[model samples]
Each structure stands twice: as C-alpha cells, then as structure tokens.
Target: MEQKFKRNIGWLQGSAMTIGAVLGSGVLVLPSLAANMAGPVSLISWGLMGVLTIPLVIVLAKLSTLYPSAGGIAAYARQAFGERAGRITGCLFLGTVPFGAPICALIGAYYLGHFFLLDAGGVTIIALGMLIIAVLANYRGIRFSGNVQALVVIGIAAALLASIIAAWPMVRKESFYPFAPNGWVPVGTVMTVLFWAFVGWEMICHLAEEFEHAKRDIKRSLCISLVVVNLLYLGLAYVTIGTGVYLEQENLTSLTGLLESGWGRLAGSIVALLGVAACYATIHTYMAGFSRLVYSEARAGNFPKWFGRLHVTYGTPYRVLIVLGPFSMMVLLTGLLLQLDMSILIQFPGSIFIALYIIAMAAGIKLLPPKSISYYCAWLACIVCIIIYLFSGWIGVYPPLLAGASWLFSRQRIRVKNGAISG
Candidate 1:
C-alpha cells in the first residue's frame, strides 16, 4: 500500500504555518522599499493591499474547506475546469517555488551579512546554508517541521514587536507633512512590489488535507493568521516611515537600522538572527507545499511516477525534498554569479504568483455555489489579481509562456502513452 500524509496539523500549528508562509523576509525590507518609492504616503499602498487581501484569503480558505487536497489550487482548477487547466495551475505555482525560495534565502542572508559586515560571497554562502537547513527540516516530516515553524513564528512576532516598540519614540511630526512627495502615482506603483508579500495565502491551501479537522481548523487558522500578519505589517510600515529610516537607508538592512536607532547595536544583530529564522520558516513551508504538489501531480500522471513515492517511515514526500536541495543550490549559485538585480529577481516570481492567483480565483468562481459569499469573494479576488497583473509590466508575459509550456508538456505525455498502448 502507498503511504499517505499524516494528519498532524492542528489549528494552532496551521495558523503558524500560514503566518510563516505569508510573513517572511518581505516584512524585513518591503516597508522601507515602498517608503523610498512613494515617501510616507506609501502607507496608503500598504493599507490598500491589506484590504484587498481579505477576499483573496476568504476565497482560498473556503476552497480549502470544500476541496481539501494536497494538489491545492491546482486541484481546484482540475475540478472546476479540466486536466489542462490543472496542469497549467500546477506548473505556474511550481515555478514560483524555485525563484521565490532563493529570493527569500538571499534576503535573509542579506540581513545577517549586514550585521556581520560580510561581502557578497559570504552572503551567498549563508543563503545556501539556509536553504539546506530548510530542506532538512521538511525532510523529517510535517509534524517535526510544523513544530519548528510554530516556534519560529513566535520569534518572528516578537522581533517585529520589538522593532516597532523600540522605534516608536523616533517618530517625527515633520515626516507627515510631505507624505505624497512623489505624488499619488507611486502609491499604486509600489503596490506592484507589495504584491509579493500577499501572494502566500494559497500556500496553506495546498496543505489543508493534513489538518486534523480540515474545515474547522483551516477556517480558524486562516482567521488567526490574517489578523497577526496584517497587524505586524501595518506596525512595521508605520515605524519605517515615521522614524525616517527609509530616507537614511532603504534596503534589506533597513530593519536593522530601525532597531539600532532606538534599542542599540545588539538589537540589530538580534533582528538579523531572527530574520534568518523568518526566512527559513517561509522556505520550509513552501518546501512542504511544493513537494506535495509535485507528488500529487506525479500521482496524476502529469510528472514521472517515481516522484509519487512517499517515505516509508515518515510518510513524507522524501523524493521531492531530496531533489529540492540540489536545485536550490544551483539557482542560488547562478544568481550570485550573474550579479542579478534584486528588483528583477523579486518581480519575476512575484508576477508568476499574481498569475497563479488569477487562475485559482477563476476556479473558485466555477466550483463554489453561485451567489454565495465565497463565490462573490472569488469574483472580487479574480478582479484584484487581474489588476495586479496589469501592473506586472513586461514580466506578465511569463504566465502565458508558462501556460504554453504546460500544454506542450501534456501533449507529449499523451503521445507517449498512446504509443505504448499501440505497441
């Protein structure tokens, strides 16, 4: 008999995993980046995205309750549309993991490098090590990784709180006068960048089947995580602008400077360590979700059947996790060698995620009962994703390109199957 995934996630662990997946290295840098772009008025962009995230989260949470599967949004696409749509959804989401994971790792490593004053090479080495650690944690099984993630979520929350409290006294009334210095246009522009931070709610949908009470716990966890994540984001954005840190230094090290300004130099080091924890937590959850996705796709015959195997002892997708380690190493090394711009790196995968959301929300519209709250929310979410993708610029071409690739891949697999049957 084939081993099945264990139901090891409870409401609290589910909430932590959800939080860890959404609130990552982006929190450490994005507030400051947005501030740099649109000045203090960037807070409007943050608030707008926070509001938009509501229906997106609700639609996804509802979908999880309705069709709890390891295939996640892809499964929903298959159920609502057909096999071709499922393959495209799966491929698009899988594309995000490879690029998104390394970006998170490097951003965390940038925080550490800022603390230790390390060069690019040292930072690349640290990023690689973080990926390996995240992979190993997932290799152990969901129970083990989920527990580690819960603890890391606590640390991440504490770090954000500390940074906000320490920087509260630094707020200047003068900072509010020239809020929209770059005009209101950049507020919308920065939303394109902020989209990356909000793309993670779907990650939890992929693991909904693992929850002890899929319907009850998934709903509870989604509510809990959304509250926690939005509060942290708003507080951090307020401080990043109020303290005028964006004007001083606007990069991954921006959070470090905010802490050092009020708490002391030691606080900078502490935030750096916790930043690494946050990044690992994000990577760890994605690794779990993506590996299961691959496993599910394989079982459906969209991939090589060998990837469908689970670990005999842990009942985890050990084969997929094994492949992730080397794949992550190669991507990180290539990025470092090429000296790629961070903006390009972030925007590419970020656009792919926007594309994935558009399709998933469309799936929700087709599957959910018409005129229900979830169905309405799905419509709103679909419109929101379309708006975001419009802002994706030229990088938006990736989704169409990826869709084409998935079609060709499915066709070739069908041809091979027919040939073997004839033989």
Candidate 2:
C-alpha cells in the first residue's frame, strides 16, 4: 500500500513553518556581512528585498492554492510548461539542500562555539550533529514537526525582539556617517547575499499538500509571516548598524556581540540557545520540503524509484530523509577540511534561488489568468528575480550549468525507457 501525506498543518502551523524557513541563519549573520559591504546603506538592500518579497510570496501562494503538491515550484513548472522544465526546476531546487542546508546548520554551530568558546573542529562536530537532529525531527512526520516548529518560531521571535529592544538605547548616530563608503554598487551586491534570507518562501509550496486547508491557509500564512519576518529583519539591521556590532566582531558572531552589548553575557548565552533552535527550525523545514520534492520527482519517474517511498506508518518521505542525512554530513566534513568561508557557501545558493524564482514566476504568468492581479504580481516577481540574478556576479554561471545537468538526466531517462521497451 502506498502512503500519502496527512493534512495536519493548519494556517498557524503553516505560518510557523514558513517563518522558520525564511528567517533562518541569515538573520544571525547577513546583517553584519551586508554592513561590511555597503556600510549603513546596506539597509537599502534589506528594504528593497523586503518590498520585493511581498509579490514573490503572493505569486507562490496563489499558485499553491491552484496547484498544491509536494513538487512545489516544480509542480507549478510542470503544470505551466512541460515535464522537462518541471524536472529541471526540481533539480535546481534540490541543489540548495546539499550546501545551503549545511550552511544553515553551521550557523547554529558557530553560535554554539561562540557561546561555549569551542574550537573550529568542535563547531564542525556540532554542525554535523545539528543536521542529524533536523533529520530526526522530520522523520517523526509533519504533525510532530509542525508542532515543534511553532514553538521554535515563537522562541526565535522573542529572542530577536529582546535583542533589538535592549540594543535600541545604545545606537550611536555617528555609525551612520559615510553610509555608502563602498558606493551604491555594493548595496545592490549585498542583495545577492541577502537573497538567502528570502529563499524559503518557495519552500512552503512543497508542503501545500500537507496543509489542512491549503488554499485558505496558504494565503493566511503568507500574510502573517511576511509582516513578521520583514519587521524583524529591518529592526535587527538597524541595531547592527547603530551599535556598530558589525565593526566589533566577526560577521558570524556579530549577533552574539550585539546581544551581549545590549543585555549582558547571560542574554548572549540565552540567544545562543535560541540561535541553535532557529537554525534547527530552518533545517527541519528544508528537510521536510526537500524530501517531499525528491519523492515527487522520483514518483514522476524523473529519478531512481528508490527515493519515492514513504514511511508506511508515519506517511513521511523517509527514504529521501535517510539519504539526506549522509549527504549533509559529507558537506559539513568537506567544508571543515577545506576551511570554506560561510559567505561562499551562502552566495552559491543565493544565486540558485534567484534562478529558481525566475522560473517559478514565469510559470505563474503562463498558468494564471491573463492580466489578473496575481499574474501581474508574478511578472513583478520575475523581473525582480532577474535583477537579483544579474547582481549575483560569477555565481550566475551556476543556473546554466544546472540546466545542462537537468537536460542530460532527461536524455538518459528517455534512453532507458526506449531500451526497456525494445527489450
């Protein structure tokens, strides 16, 4: 008997999951990195991305209402275009899991190292452990995972609020001088980095089938998460600039310094724990989303069938989750051995996501009613995606490479089918 996903997610759970996915490690690190690149004017990138997020989420949410499936953006692509396009989009999205998920886990590990004064190797070990824990959480199924996500989201919100409030009085006006020290070009450049924070909106469409009332709840969740996420982003960016925490600590641990300066060592310790939880929540949501996408693609005969199986008892995509565990460990280990910078890991996926969004929004234009409000929104989103992709610099080369890989896979699949038929 084949198992199907359970409709255990409501609007609140959907919101929590969406929030967790979008508000991940980027919040902890990107502000400082952005400040480093563009000075205080980096806030412009944050503001621009926040405004752009509105239309992107709307196009995705509207699509989910119309075609909810585990395949997410790929499903929309399949419906709007053809199977080859769909498969390519799915593979492109899968690309993020390999490096992006582990980068998120490493953020938590960095915070843990900061809080405990651990060495680089210890941080690597903690990162690997965080990936394992995330896989375990998803193995329990979405009902259990959704409940856990809600609590994690609340804690993340509270921690961000507390940090911002405590740091408000310490904000020095002098920090705003020479705002565009690197010129406005870097402000646009930083948006490429900040794109990682906004990457998760498309993730929820993968879980659309699991929502109890996907059409209604999807919109509701988007509305709630958008406001909540943008506010936290802007507030945190303000304090990071005002307190000049970016100038004080390494970008990875800037949040710790921000919290310590505002509250104290105790608050920093508490935030470290919360940062770990926030990163776990991110890993948890992406784990769930990526596994489901693999199952969908495999079920559609785009990959090996071995990945298509769901856990009979839990109704979850257990096989894919199991495979993800090992792959993530390998990425973490390789990152440690090579001493890779987190920004490099982050920029790779940020570029890939912009490419993915461009396709997703194009799918919207094709599938949605012509000139409808959502259709216009899709156009707006697609345009912004293109602009961001241009800002991705050399990283922009990745999308064409992924497209080539997808074409090769499709050709091989066709050859196999023809051979089997002749045999």
Candidate 3:
C-alpha cells in the first residue's frame, strides 16, 4: 500500500513556505529588470502587481478550502472542466518544472559567482550542486522541507530588512524626478515582468492537503504571506530604486550592487548568500509542489502508475523526484552550455503560470456558488489574468501552444486505449 502524507504543517510553516517561495529570485532581480524597462516608475508596477494578485489569491484560497487536494489547481480544473482540462493543467504545471527550476538555480548561481568571484565553469558546477541539495531535501519529506523553508524564509526576510535599513540613508528624493521618463506605457510592460514575482501563492495550493487544518490554516497562511511578501517587495524596490544602483548597471546581481553602494562589499556578499538561500527556498517548495502534482496525476491515471509510488518510510513522491531532478538538471545544462539568455527561460514559465492562473480562476467561477464573493473574485481574477497575458507579448503564445498540443496527444492516447479495450 502507498503511504499517505502526514498533515504536520500548521499556519506558521505554511505561511513561511508561501512567503519563501514568493521572495525568491524575483526580489533579488525583478526590480532591476523592471527599472531597466521603466525607471523609478517601475516601483509603481511592483505595487500594482501586488494589489492585482489579491483577487487571484482570494479565489485560490476559496478553491483550496472547498476542495483540498494534493493536485491543487489540476484538481480544481478536473472538477470544473473534466478529465481533459485537468490533464492539460497538470501537464502545463509540470512543464514549468523544466524551465522554472533551472531559472531559480541559475539565479542562485549568478549570485554565488558574484560572491565567490567564480567563472562560468564554477557557477555551473555550484548551480548543479544546489539542485542536488534541493532534490535530496525534498525527497526526505514535506515536513523536512517545511522546516528548512521556515528557517530560510527567516534568513531572507532578515537580509532584506537589513538591506533596507542600510540603504535608508542613501535614499534621495531626486530619484523620483524622472520617474516616468519612459511614460505609462512601459509601466504596463514592466508590470507583466513583475507579475513573475507573484506566482508562488498558487503553487502553495498543492500543499493544501498536507496542512493540518486545510480550511482555516491555508486561508490564514496565504493572507499573512500576501501581506509580508507585498511589504518586502515594495520595500526592496524602494531601496533598489532610491539608491540608483539599477539605473547604473542592469545586471542580474543588482540587489548586491544596491547593498554594496550603501554599505560595502561585505554587506553585498552577505545579501548574495541570502539570495542563494531565497533560491533554495523557492526551488524546494516548487519541487515539493510539482512532485505532488505528478503523484496526483498518476493516481488519476493521467500519468504512469509508477509515478504514484511513495517512499515507504518518508511518504514522499520519490519516483517523481527521481525523474524530475535529472530532467531539470539536463535543461539547466543545456541552457548554460548554449548560453541562452536567462530572461527567456524565466519569462517562458511566467507565461505558463499566467495561463494556469486563468484556468484556476475559471474553475473557481464554475465550482463556487454563483453571485457569491468567491465567484465575483474569480471573475475579477480572470480579467486581471487576461490583461497580464496580453501584456506578456509573444512569450504568452507558448502556453496555449503547449496546452493544445498536450490536449491533442492525450485525446489520441485515449482513443488508442479505448480501441484496445473494445478489441
């Protein structure tokens, strides 16, 4: 018999995991990227994206409360749209792992390189090492990952707080002068990019079944995490922009540059290490969530039965981890070897995530009672998702293509199986 996951998580751990996942590479890099696109006005984009996510979060929270499942968003899709939609949602969410996890690892690797003065070869080696550690930590079980995530979130929060304090004195009012030099149009463009930072909230839904009190605790955790994440993100953007570091050099390690400008190299190095910790937290949570998604699909017969197997003692989805870890590493290696722009890798997953969000919100509208607050929120969220998708440009095209392809392939497989059974 397959062992079941233990519901060992409480509100604190759940909130920590959500916040940790949200605070990852985005906080470390997106502000600089957004600034390069929109100047100080990008700070408004940060705040705007944060506010826009509230409706989406509310809808997801309601869905999780009503129908908690290991499959999370995929389960919601199944309830609302039946088996095919569910399978496609599962595939899209799972597809994110190949591109998304490597992006997180690369973010950490870039920072590690800055901190250690390592070359490309050294960064690749360190990134691969971090990926291994994340895989092992997740294989141990959710409880173990939850604990590590709690500590990591604390470290990241503290580091950001320190960076804010250190940079407080250097903040100048003049930084706001040429704020919209690129005008409001770029703000919309940058909002699409900043939306990447807000993707983690929905990922936490996959762990809803693992929470001790899924109904009350998941809601509380997401609410608390939302507040914390918004404050930290806005604060980080304020300091990064005020210090004018992003304007000077729009590199991946711009947060470190911001800190170094205010304090020195030592402070910059400490923050870089914290960025590495943030990456681990995000990767750990995503691995845990993605593995459960695979386990849920397997159990539903969407994937091979082997993927549903659990570790006898740990109750973790060991098979999924075994398969996914190496696959992600291969993708990471390909990106590194080919010297692909990290932005392409990052933006690719963001598109899929937005598509997933649209589906989840649509599911909420279908599942929840009509005219209820949850239903209304779902409607608003769907609109916001559509707007973001439009702003996402050509990158947005990939998710629909991926989904259509998966749907067609799945339908063909079903036809073949049905024919075999009839014969």
Residue-by-residue lDDT tens digits, candidate 1, 24-59 = 878888999999999889899999999989998999
* Among all candidates shown, the one with the greatest lDDT: 2
**What digit string (tens of lDDT, one per residue) describes model 2 on residues 1-423?**
665788888988889999998888778888899999899999999999999889899899999999989999999999989998998988897678877888888888877788789999898888898898889889988988888889999999998999899889989999999888888998778887788788788888999889998889999999999999999999999999999999989987788788887677686687678778888888888888999999999988887899988888788999998989999889888888888898677777777878888999999999999989999999999998898788778878987898898889888988998999999
Least well predicted 10-residue stretch by lDDT in candidate 1: 342-351
**Poorest lDDT segment (10 consecutive residues) of candidate 3:** 249-258
lDDT for 16 in candidate 3 is 86
Using alpha carbons, what is the TM-score of model 1?
0.95
Between candidates 1 and 2, the lDDT winner: 2
In candidate 1, which residue ranges exceed 4 Å CA deviation? none
TM-scores for every predicted model: 0.95, 0.93, 0.95
Q: Compared with the true structure, what per-residue lDDT tens digits does model 3 show for residues 12-66?
A: 8899889977878778778778878898988888888888889898999999999
- Cα deviation at 235, candidate 1, in Å, is 0.6
What does each candidate score in C-alpha RMSD?
Answer: 1.7, 2.1, 1.8
